[model samples]
Target chain A: MKSVEDINEKIREGSVCVVTAEEMKEIVKELGAEKAAEEVDVVTTGTFGAMCSTGVFLNFGHSDPPIRMQRVWLNDVEAYTGIAAVDAYLGATQQSEKAEDYGGAHVIEELLKGEEVELKAISKGTDCYPAKEVRTVITLEDLNFAEMVNPRNAYQRYNAATNSSDRLLRTYMGTLLPNFGNVTFAGCGEISPLNNDPEFRTIGIGTKILLCGGKGYIVGHGTQHCPGYATLMVKGSLKSMDPEFLRAAYMPGYGVTMFVGIGIPIPVLDSKMAEKLAVRDEEIKTKILDFGVQRRDRPVVREVTYAELKSGRIEINGEEVRVSPLSSVYMARKIMEELKRRIERGEFLLTFPVERLTPGKALKPMKTAIKLVKSVMSEAIVISPETSVEIAAKIMIEKGVNHLPVVENGKLVGIVTSWDVAKAVAMGKTGKVGEIMTKRVIVTYPEEAVELAAKKMEENDISALPVVDKSMRVLGIVTSEDLSKLLAR
Target chain B: MFLRLRFDSKAVRKPVISAVTLKTSALINIIKAEVGPRRGELIVEVDDSIAEKVEKAFEELGVEVLRLKEKVERNERCVHCGACISICPVEAIVLQDGRVEFLDKCVLCGNCVKVCPVKALKLPTT
Candidate 1:
């Protein structure tokens, strides 16, 4: 077995042999691990996907009148400025106040691409720094320092996401079609760095890596890292990185996020390392999760290998589902190749981890969620506007439902209650139910807090509210009965 | 070629797709389907050589045939991450030689268009 120092000496002398994670599989299969380890010095692995827990730290040069900024916004996207004067950390997912589809990720990409950005900051004005506000444009070259510090990235494996419910699910995993219609997953499987080194034999703090096409280092075990499942906290010089490797993704229904390109080079110190590098797509498995459930602990439908997922088909609960990749295996392969070329050309070298990554607690979610209209609402029974009062009354009695939303062409037009039917019968009115139905119906969205629905019902003296979407399509019905049941609990 | 067939209640019960495929000797691979007694929608792919023949045969069978030739216009914003590869119901996108390649098998399902984070892909109706 060779050492990292020996591999570094070979790299310096331009005598090192490097292969990408993709090519290592074939070489090891032909030569076997023992021979392949002696032939290759490093194996480059990479992955690219939408990583939300990432951001940048920027040091805007001090202005003429120094100010300790209290608030900061880059292109109308707020940046955290609680650290120091002219310093801020802009998260990748923060949305822009000025517009939709624009966010901190876009701002970061613009800077990396050498474009000027509008910077506005406000301060309370201290004696040492008297300026209360500053507004100006700055490019990447103008910043004192620009470093990308991603707290969590390069997940070892991510569960594939699918939806089993009858409605479209727009999530960070992309759009999951209703009724297990499609599957979207991340991780490049065999070529992914963490998958290659599952036990962190060479990955940990101070491990040199390529971040956005620039040299970077792993800082520590990323937040939420637990046993067997590894992640990374890495930092790189943002100013030196190439914009081609970093991109901002404006996911429809979800906010903006960044596609981070990360490449890790593992020194083939022995046959054991070579065997690990030879792991195939079929060997790496990730769970399939149902994103339809709007809870922290979404139920796992099944386990699938990346090979099965990449084949565009997988069986879920006795049904075959169409599969897709949320992570770009193509881009990940590109990064691996690029890193391999750099290593072979002596421009890049491998480094041993100064400290190994250790297991930690899993991610902790909020203990309680404020009950929403959706939580208590029941399925809505709908009726056409032309239904006769006699039929409406008969239907209410047969169905035992108090309220029925009067719909015309799939839109909520009016609401008819059992009380309306009683009044209609008492008044001996034989006209259509539309005439007696409440036209100015009170409504609440499914996402709205239950308390708001309660207040609306109490103030308006209405016992129920129809839950509708933005386009007035009826979803469900929430009533005093449901709220009272919840309150009793 | 990728095609979407709409069958009215009258035609849905007749097994139109089977008859058309038998007539043209072309196997039809369905991507997604939604059907009831009233109406039905089917997205399918056929061999490029037999695409026009299959379309005509389906239309003759009282099925509304729409040629899904609409393309995904990939701009410079695309990172070629292959996220769109898996989301394409028709498997029109694939990675070849470390690059994302778009094939003629696209059905214009639009899942990739919605899933793209950078909005690099757009399906402009032709």
Candidate 2:
């Protein structure tokens, strides 16, 4: 395993990122044709199924030519049919004796415009009109070198099956999805309440995510399941999608699609219970088996701005609400609606104002609090400065903790919480904490009154405060526990 | 999709030989187009000396090669466990046991063959 220091060093070195599709294309170009071909292991002949299956083959080194292809086969086809293409490609490979052989009328030079291509007829009618053969142009996507199994059949099936919705769905059915109740989102919205929660350090920015929901939420992460509403949001580059359009495109037969992200979890007896329920029947087998590992105990209901619900900006009967760092789901929804309406109307600032709390003039000093300064504090959650808000949410769930103290130069500078983590997660930031952590942290002097600390806690809605000295070193944490002890005495 | 290859006997070397022993392995030149320069061709020559040893190795590794032809009457032999699944940096494995059972996601660096437990999974012989 890479140590915290090593990971930090890599982060400091910074990464060369391709910011846009144009940039990514340019990088491929820079790699040059021969390198590109060398990098290109397999080509999929343009189908979502083919692309994904070829992706799997490329992933596993099972595909002989080592590259699945797409696009060059598309010709003038505006949109390539994702799944059907995969099936045709599979047919070609399975029946062939030559491992790297490529022969198929399946590669359609003409795109299926209004009708599905008659694959069977095409296969039978071998040679007729020949302009150019449809071949999926091959390109190599860089690898993360991460240990991920070829996704279960269901993963590709469902992701491909869903069409126009902006919200991508990843499910863990049967034993394929691990037994963890953590999910990370990358780059999307800006929600603040998520910024103050305890589980805030683990999320990263702009990275692939694994969401663990269901049983893992309740059991592993100690959270109370409140009846929170969930509203799915789908945003595309163009405003061409609507609820009905999405419904038609994605959720055709299924009443609704439940998408959750998670991580590896500690196995428990409840998983056995889920297994029993799954084995009893076939249809719900996936659900039962999935429940064994899913951490849904902690309910993270999706919430949208109230204005969207009222004005029908985004329609669906789920619920309309706002989520605030301090406000409960009920109040937060109303506030969020009004706030979002203001934002849409250009009445609000894009970012929240930063507030640094300290001792006020009227506050009294502590009886025996001494400001002994220390250079550093142990027992802290160290995260990269660039980790995004969404990834922080995942980190919280995976680490089974809520608070991640942001450190710089081996000294605590800022702090992040579960709420902040969630907000960052929802916003889809995959950057480090330095980018999201509260740069302006509230520090209480040792000479500050207990009442002042109490007020700070209440005003900031924080559970603890780092008592610091003049040198900006953390002396001690004046926590809720300490306050409670004082009250008892 | 989830079957492990095991030998009939516990001997290690014989099973290893039997596992790679294709009924009629393709010639090296044909395989070269696919495997490229880094790796050499694969040819299935019936060497009785290695067959028993191959089977023994497979058995020793606790692999049970699923005999689809004999048991299920299907000629298909390999299942896509992605011996190289965890190792690949780029997410190449797009589909398995689905449409396009194998993908060109491979780097063709011969890592999968090295990791193949049964030695049956390999690049086509040149």
Positional deviation of residue A299's Cα in model 2 after best superposition, in angstroms: 50
Q: Which docking band does candidate 2 fall into?
A: incorrect
- Candidate 2 docks with a DockQ of 0.01
On residues A1-489, what C-alpha lDDT tens digit does candidate 2 reach at each position?
222233233324442110111122233446643443233211100001111111111111212222222221222212222332222122111211222112111211111012232121111112332222233332222211111111211110111010111222232111111222211111101121211111211211111111111111111111121111111111111111111111000111111111112211110112221121111101110111122212222222233332222121222233221110100122122233433333234332221112211111232444674322122222335555556666677777887666666666657688787777667668886567777677666766666556766777898888767766667665565666667766587
Model 2, B31-105: lDDT tens digits are 112223332222222234444444344445555432111111111222222222322222333233221133433
Lowest lDDT 10-residue stretch of candidate 1 chain A: A359-368
lDDT of each: 0.87, 0.28
TM-score of 1: 0.77
Please name the candidate that would achieve the greatest DockQ relative to the true structure. 1
- Interface DockQ per candidate: 0.43, 0.01
All-Cα superposition RMSD per candidate: 7.7, 31.1
Candidate 1 lDDT, A193-248, residue by residue in tens: 99898778899889999999999999998877876567899999997798878898
Docking class of 1: acceptable
